[model samples]
Target: MRSLRKFLYWLNIVGMIAYLIVCGYFQMTGKPLYPGQVGLMFQVASGLVLVSIPLIIEKWAHVALPDILVVLYELFILMAILLGTGMQAYSIPNWDKFEHLFSAGMLAGSGFMIYAARTPADKQDQIDPFLIALFGAAFGVLLGVCWEFYEFTGDSLFGMNMQRYMAAGKPLIGHPVLYDTMGDLLSDFIGSAGMSLYAFFKIRRDHSWLNTFKLHRIK
Candidate 1:
């Protein structure tokens, strides 16, 4: 599992580097680039940094994130930034919504990890399952909102249509403009809620389930 995790990390690094090189080559050759290609280049570069964060935290903070979580995080970056943006997979119907749903669920799992890390192992079973579910759901929703804020900022500052507010160089109007954002939020909520319920039930049945997902402090 550790080897697989390391492979994914390197795969993202190499993939992003290759993408940047290709983009740079196209620009230097004066080749026509696709619309939003420039924005995707920025995303690819940012993804490189994003995928490296786990190692940075582990090395510098003396903390150890679970291998499964790290693998999931790296895979999300690979699919979302490397393939979704680079290959224009967002053009596929419903792909963006799927990504949002998956991301929220993963983030909810992260919330559980955070909660488990803070609670003493002996007292974990004593905590209310309702609180656990609420915390995970809230945390996932909060991060989902933060991501929307990021998309809005990117659209405003970079002229990117990340929020889907514009089409064909024209701004959308009425309910259509609200559709994408609202849909994304709804998907996020559903995904998080589902994961929270899973956590609530699993923890109630077996507190040992968290042991598989818990983070560790390095000595």
Candidate 2:
């Protein structure tokens, strides 16, 4: 875990620097960066937050997550840059759908881990795996809804049109808006549901699926 965290630490540093440089270049050249590109700046800020996750957990939550999950999240941070801001997933056909699906799964998994972390060691034997899994799945869906809200806010305030009200380079008319929103929500549901069910069944057999993942520092 330490080794993976170290690697992610440096990787984030380099990626953020390179990303900011590119954004700066676009600004200096007076090239109009897409709203997604403009959003890359915020992604860079978030990368810093991801890099700090370990420290935050160690200090506040005192939860030591598995190296694998830590690594997965670091990769997600990288994904936020490359696939999201750099590759511009929102602009590409079908990429947005894939992003929502993948993100929902990851979020569900993380939410399960967090639920486990909050469990006290003495009471862990009494913990309900099924309930936690359900909560995690619901948490993932909640995040998906919040994300749509974010897109709506962006569209309302800055004309980002992230909600696809202005889709395909033009204002969406008729059922198009409903179609786009529903599609994204559907993708979110598929991903979260799969992860939650897996966790639910797995935990029924192996309680350690959540309890003993080389995490649980507070114990």
Summed backbone clashes in each candidate are 0, 0
State, as a TM-score between 0 and 1, how close model 1 is to the true structure.
0.82
* The 10-residue segment with the lowest total lDDT in model 1: 27-36
Model 2 misplaced regions, further than 4 Å: 1-12, 16-51, 55-62, 66-69, 118-129, 212-215
Give the number of the best model, judged by lDDT: 1
* Overall local distance difference test of candidate 1: 0.86
TM-score (all chains, Cα) for each model: 0.82, 0.70
Residues 47-139 of candidate 2 have per-residue lDDT tens digits of 777666766886798766665456656666666655566646545776667767767887787787677677765665576877877887898
**Tens digits of per-residue lDDT for model 1, 1-219:** 699999999999998999889887886687836566778788889998899999999999998887867876887788798888887887798788888877888888898888888889889888888898899999999999999999999999999998899989999989899888888998899989988898789888887887766877899
Output the lDDT of residue 180, model 2: 74
